[model samples]
Target: MNFSEVIKQSNQVCKVSPDGKYLATCVQYRLVVRDFNTLQIVHLYTCLDQVMHMEWSSDSLFILCAMYKRGLVQVWSLEQPDWHCKIDEGSIGLVSSRWSPDGRHILNTTEFHLRVTVWSLCTKSVSYIKYPKACQKGMDFTADGHYMALAERRECKDYISVFVCDDWHLLRHFESETQDLAGLEWSPNGCVLAVWDSCLEYKMLLYSLDGRLLSSYSAYEWSLGIKSVAWTPSSQFLAIGSYDEKVRILNHITWKKLTVFEHPAIISNSKAVLFKEMEKRAVVGSEDLSVHQLTVGNSLFSTQSKYEITQLPAKVSVVKPDPDHANPKIGISAMAFSADNRYLATKDDNMPQSVWVWDMQRLGLLAVLEQTAPIRCFVWDPRRPRLALCTGNSKVYLWSPAGCVSVNVPVEGSFQVQSLFWHCSGGSLILLSKEQLCLCYMDTEEKDQSTSSDCNFTI
Candidate 1:
């Protein structure tokens, strides 16, 4: 409900620490660390080159800045400003770099997916992992930060390797049933590892912590199978988005399809409430003293938006993707579960401007959000059963079981929200624009987290 001054960011690399204390953002070759609550600069450090990627260590004590083109990674400690470490891959080349779950170990993958190098800050030792596969999401660490599952490609066969993060030892290595492993993720409980195949195969397999295959599932014998996957906070249900423009919920016990939700252009359901965003230009008033609020062509006060509950049987527009395209845009590309695991929100690529929310208890659609622009990103509040989403516009939209509301980013100049991130406390949000970023402090004092039979998601 409130906003902070816009801060300039060079790259799209901005992250909040897991401890919800510091905010890190990259500007050209400088890394700026600020206090999350006060937005005051606490520390500033220079990097070797332009920062291509940036992340915070799990403990939130250190920050890592990576320059892929230069094959360099720089780590800075907040407690000891002068104590900084730099890891240079030299000519070997560095394609990806990240921190291990331990917050002390750094993992750098070489170019061409040749190998992974693990650097330890505590032990000052180096460990090398071979056969690292080049995929979208090939590496994942469990929630407890104890184990890591890595997808590997060995002799034309797909494999998975589980390693203990304490010493980076190979605990288990086994061949995967996937023809081409696309992505893999560990459940929130860290009990099961879910691996899905490429767009060509509609196969999904679940494996145990010890590399034993637990379950296999396939929705249909079609292409562009699984686009996205999400596990409930409780890890009781696994939601998989597929190319068929549907989301299939699988129970943790059976891992079988418990229910399927489809996105139809025509919505005639009475149980679902549809909130459509409407934008209109504000009529400039001749309030002589307030002329300072005006800009050259358009300013923050130029236009405003609001959400109106539209009548049922509404027809939403859909953009059909070309079949010959490399990555067709016609599937359920995004999904998120509420922190309480009571609601599920999804976005279908074909209906770019729509977001659907489903109820897990009644197992039905609750509300539908139809925006004027494509839904860029949506995330659930960590503390409650609320959802916040952003379009490539100057406003942020939110939905809850109680109702829906759209708030404009009160700022001068054009600050279109490209994406958004929520603070761990869910009391504030970091809204990123083209080259600017701002923090949105939510007004939770007046609002209560009470839900009625009718919620904020539409079918």
Candidate 2:
């Protein structure tokens, strides 16, 4: 694996263009755009306030930066370097900013103002809407880019307002039963809108496009409510990850639980036994095995409590800790489904060997990687059948069904790999460690060589 050092310095935030041609990074108040392959600087712009957030247009032609302290947002285009547009709110600073799906409009939320402003790049016009002050991220656009859902507070009541994309007009507003709405997300097919409350509430409400409540789910009293929720690409299943250390899958058709997955508890009767003959050839020592037994009971949950969901007999899968002494007991912290939805990758909170890849269809363990450093995050390529794993240290491992390849990214100062981005073509990967951003060109020919290796095995 060969990676070109793009920026050796630390950056506050970094993003790669969707098309994978340009790499953008924000350091202090400077935003630099560079060529992905050559690592050559292309465009550079300095902001008045430190750029807190940055995003690229869908077409990858324009770069947008949000300045919270100055209450301003600057939109810069690669095509027009000298000409740039700014969205400034005088007294109330901008709290958050996002790009429309079409990349023709920019959305800005005002700090403590209970207002949201939409700016159109084509018409040079602005539209304002009332929003809830308590709802920090209570807005989302559908995947198809036709409608937008916003949760707002109206006269002490919480309501979800739907808007049309063309005119940005209110289509309908439906009041929600819960006053504290935490987050909003639209299904991949743009059929349903899911809204959930903070940890205080155990509610997950689903609504249709017309703002009608379709279905609702709640966590059990023993569980700590939901930590995150994700919809399958087909929109047939919804996976809810809860603080209770369980993953529950919901059947969208019936709006009920279909299956439950949880971390396996240690079996009291199971013992670590090694034959006298095999002990001589063993790679691990008995002392290590004894330590593993001592830490086996350190799981986050004790007794598994079943929650009611239409009384359907749920298919359950339990992920057990690795039996090997080299691996440690750790809770799952990050997970991602492959773009094809055929594979699921999960990583533990603090153990390197806790990364497991599973066949989503069969719900069976595919591979348990032997890692060195603890993993920070892992992502599957959107355009290819490959996975990239980022570790707590500045190391990244790329894996396919056949074999794995690893790379150690160099850092000038104390830093860790914060994020990874695979190019749309799957030919390159961008790694953002602290303020430094690096790009590696993936050698496709290695796939064949890796598959032929004796150590390589298929999932």
Candidate 3:
């Protein structure tokens, strides 16, 4: 893999356009647009305030910049630069804003979850949705973007409202069985809606499009419950991560637990490949030259990383959380299914440095990646089952069926990759540090290249 030069960004990292043609980044109050392939400046626009959030329209013809603190949202058009629009929430105090599915409307949720205001750009009309509850994921849109599901609270009862995106009209409203509805997600096929309760209750209910409860599942009614959940792209399996450091997979047809995956500190499974990241710094002499690539010593601070396969019986580090703490550092806090639904990657907060990969076909452990530092983020390639992650360091780690490899960002040891995301095309990666970002171009010819002899390929 090769890396491009580092570029400056804001606290809000840049985003790749949904259509995969443009890149948008905000530097303070300025928004910069660039060609995704060439990385050249395409357009620049100044916002009214420092952008707290940035989003691209569904059609990729417009950009939305939101300044919640200012209670303002600005929309810029790519087709006509001069045609810009602004919406002010006035005294309602905006907390969150997002683009509607059609990209012709904007939805702004006022502070304290009072209501959701939908502003139509084409018709110049406004719609109001009240009683919006503030939860982990109170709103979700189906894959086709035709319908939206929102969790609502009214008179201490948990309710769900399904609305049609075309006219923002309420389609169905029904009370849910959840005590404290934490989040809701629509299935990829848009036929099922998964509503999960707060961590205090171990409850998950599947509802049909017409607000009918299809099935309900609860593992146990004790301690903490669900922390994260994800659905396979094929909509065949639903994986639920709980506070017990276990993942329960449910089949789409039966809506029953197909299997349970446990994250153990001691990894002794012979079939599971264990990879340990090793980092080293290269020494450099005083003499150096860089005009036309003459003899020059490498920077002493430049770090290189590689993955080494460890034998079985490896012990991963575990930090026990204090019981008196309000939010204990335990359970499977992060879980993601690969795009192809062949692999699932998960992280247990208590085991801060280890990542577990599970094989969906066999429903068993596949690999374990133990990084030296805590993992900040991990994402899957959009077009493949490849996985990439970062540890708040200057390197990006990748794992494919072939093997695992670690590549450093070529910024002379200045850029640390705190988080990263793969482009929509899965051709490159956007690595973000505290206030800077860069691009990593994966060599297409060796996109599935094998790692060193020390590494072990799982598939």
Clashing pairs in 2: 10-435, 11-435
Per-residue lDDT of candidate 2, residues 14-71 (tens digit): 7888887888888788888988777688999988878889999989989999888888
Which stretches in model 3 have alpha-carbon errors above 4 Å?
A: 285-301, 446-459
C-alpha positional error of residue 165 in candidate 1 after TM-score superposition, expressed in Å: 0.8
Candidate 2 TM-score, C-alpha based: 0.78
- Whichever of 1 and 2 has more lDDT, that candidate is 1
What TM-score would candidate 3 get against the native? 0.95
Per-residue CA lDDT of model 3 for 144-238, tens digit only, reads 99999999999999999999999888999999998999999999999999999999999999999999999999999878999999999999999
Instruction: Give all TM-scores, in the order shown.
Output: 0.94, 0.78, 0.95
lDDT of 3 at 382: 91
TM-score of 1: 0.94
Q: Candidate 3 local accuracy as lDDT?
A: 0.88
Model with the higher lDDT, candidate 2 or 3: 3
The CA lDDT of each predicted structure is 0.88, 0.68, 0.88
lDDT of 1 by residue, 76-195 (tens): 999999999999999999999999987999999999999999999998899999999999899999999999999999999999999998888889999999999999999999999999
In Å, residue 354's CA in model 3 sits off its true spot by 1.2
Error of 1 at 143 (Å): 0.3
Task: Tell how far residue 128 is off in model 1, in angstroms.
Answer: 0.5
